[model samples]
Target: MVSVHVTTEVFPFDQSVDLCPDNDALNFTTIFLITFGSGPTLFSNKTPADFNFTTSHSQSFTFDVNDGMFAFVNEVPDLNNGWHGNASDYTTNDTDGYMFLVNMQGIDPQIFNYKIDDLHIGRLYEFSAYVANVVRKEKCLNKPNIRFEVRAINESGNVIAKKGTGDVPACYNMSWSKYDISFETTHSSVVLLMLSNVAEGSGNDLAIDDIELRVYSTNDLDDTSTTASSIFDCKNNDEDYCECSNDFIGLSCKIQSDDVCSKHDNNTYESLFFITFGSGSDRFYSKTASDFNFKTDLKKESWSNFKPGAYAFVNSVPSSLTVLWHDAAKDHTTNDTDGYMYLAGVGNVNDMIFNYNITNLCVGVDYEYSAYLTNVMRDIRWVSVTEPNIRFEVRAVHKKGDLIAQKSTGDIPVYQHMTWSKHGLSFVATSSSVVLLMISNVGGHPGNDLAIDDIQLRVSSANQTGFCYPG
Candidate 1:
């Protein structure tokens, strides 16, 4: 029999044996309960009485074998080897059917024995061993050594768990050896046991005694008693107060102590207004409400934010304004600045410069003539003089025709708006009398290739809208 070391007050196991106490004041083999001052107390069996102490009370207890007796001894002469059972039958092959053997030839007799089958799963077993060298050996003499091994095996003969050490020094004469083996089972199985010392030839003579094993079950472990806010109260696997998070594929779980990991656009008006033309690139600018000149292809136009109702004037030029006259005998090359303007390539048919004539001006009045031009690639020729060096001169034939206004060029580039003043002059409308605003090639050629964006001949302020021009 092997005994585990326990304090008279309370202490953990000191050997490799199952403990089964009979009172409530004691403990089971595999569990531990902690108390102040003393570190931890272990038990192999439950005690039947409560531990009623008043700091001065003394209680004493004793432990003895509860069930079967396992013995390892040699009855001389025939030499036994290990732990032996009582019953045997040679007809069935069994390890327990014969007596254990110990060879005592040329060396002293030796006995290495232990017991550990009583511990259950999730139990902590503490153990220690003692050995006596009955015949000390020095140089070809007898010396005894002991080894211990605990293997948890299932019913199918599989060794599922094992932990042990095999080197224990021997003691002279009647001596004691001690060791503690702690084991916990993760599966349900019956344990197989072995105790020996490097089983080989000669030099073996010792007796092993007082082997101890104590068990600690799962219920014996303690829980943290502090509050949640205390750092000491946190467990290793708890995630609420994580210290670090695992990182995988741009996603991660934060290990923050008390926080959640979170994706972090700013919207402004300056980012909205973008210039989309030119190259495929974009440029941003403040969207201001004002007039601007828009250009496309080879043509240019003046546009403004002001909208028009009914009709609008491009300068003093009216929308769809026209001039009309028909004469088969007249040369009609005279330049007229009465209520109309001219554009290049108008009447240069087959080299005969046929000028357009505005025929029926109200007699004896003033009127204003204006011209507008866009994308003027070359200098255009114009007859600005009222009197013709050819056949006619521009005079106010009506009171509205007297206001012949003219300007060389308007303030807007690619946009021309000139008015001819006819306020002080007047003339009569004969049958062949015609008005002209000639558009011949200036600086020596024809086909000036200029666009007349919007031209008009309206009474002053007839259908005027806001004009788009530079100040």
Candidate 2:
């Protein structure tokens, strides 16, 4: 007989076990109950202690007899001896000073059913246990292969959710490892935690301990603060809060921000406009309202000739330029479908420059300007520029020609293949009216011809605290 101790008022037990002369030396060969703060609790002191395990509770088991299939004991088998593999072969911390051992030949799969009640509807719960194969030898033919499963059952005995550990071999030399199974309950009902053997021979055996079931609320698993807003709110510091969108980081959402410009083109902002050869035809933008277009022309004459005030020129030299539109037969990549701006510079004359007069920008707000650039390749007859390096620059200027912010893609290799690359920079706007966006090829090399597309300028809304860059 085993003696039981009741310590907490919350847990009450009615059954009693006769005390053994030496409680520590008592080795029971049948299922029994041992009392402790954290170890497995008893369903009842009766013959079969199954079907009473509940949430947030644990139960411990041990082998009943040496040759018997299932048994419960207070200690692990001795080290490296027939039943015991090594001195250290045991459960984790041996909290209850007990463990359940399963003999492979007799009871290949030992099932334990738990009755769960008072569970909240639509709640998630985690069931886990520490399991290990008691075998220590690497080449031992009877290595214990075990698995743990958790299944939820409704009042009608219908299974709602089931999860399991397929196969966990005792390859860790008797060391204990945890197995976890989680399920979201649809209806308040019972849950079953089962442990079974995958190996069938006699030498295959396993030990299990520290079984636990825990319930968690949805709010506990959500990382985002409910008090924060989805979009960044830079103004109301007291009442306004922010939970930066994915890819955006920083406090106040003032740092690394989302790409305002994707692979698309649009006049979403009234101040936004594109520089093209004609009023509307051959626009240096995509034909698709929100898609990028990367089309080129053999000669600048194919479109309207460059006119002063319509386009920005760097060297004051007239050169042929065109907007490339998407043509399935010509474009190498489908990434830029609408079209892109192209410059066919004359040798020794660097004259490509783009200027836009933007209005109504928020003063003192940080903004990011970005665009995609690549070397255009049309046909074998088209001359390929092998400058090896190309430089692109962007600057924000006032109507008075005062430079507000300036950034550049220092130097990029002009590969022979057609591959578009993104370049961008962040800046703080100083004024709202007449903000000028200057896109230029600062390289002095005349043949620095390239294609530019998907230009965008938007306010940066990523958190900008302590060394964090704008997203």
Instruction: Score each candidate by Cα lDDT.
Output: 0.24, 0.37
Over 107-222, each residue of candidate 1 has an lDDT whose tens digit, in order, gives: 11123222224345555443333333333211222233322334444554433222222222221212223333333444443332333322223434443333333443333432
Q: Which ten residues in a row have the lowest lDDT in candidate 1?
A: 223-232
lDDT score, candidate 2, position 205: 60
Q: What is the lDDT of candidate 2?
A: 0.37
Q: Give RMSD (Å) of candidate 2 vs. truth.
A: 26.3
- lDDT tens string, model 2, 337-445? 3323433432221233434556556656555555565544332212222221222223345445544533333223333345667654445556565343333322223
Q: Give me the runs in candidate 2 sitting further than 4 Å from their true place.
A: 1-68, 79-96, 105-108, 142-147, 152-156, 171-173, 197-199, 219-471
**C-alpha TM-scores of all predictions:** 0.24, 0.33
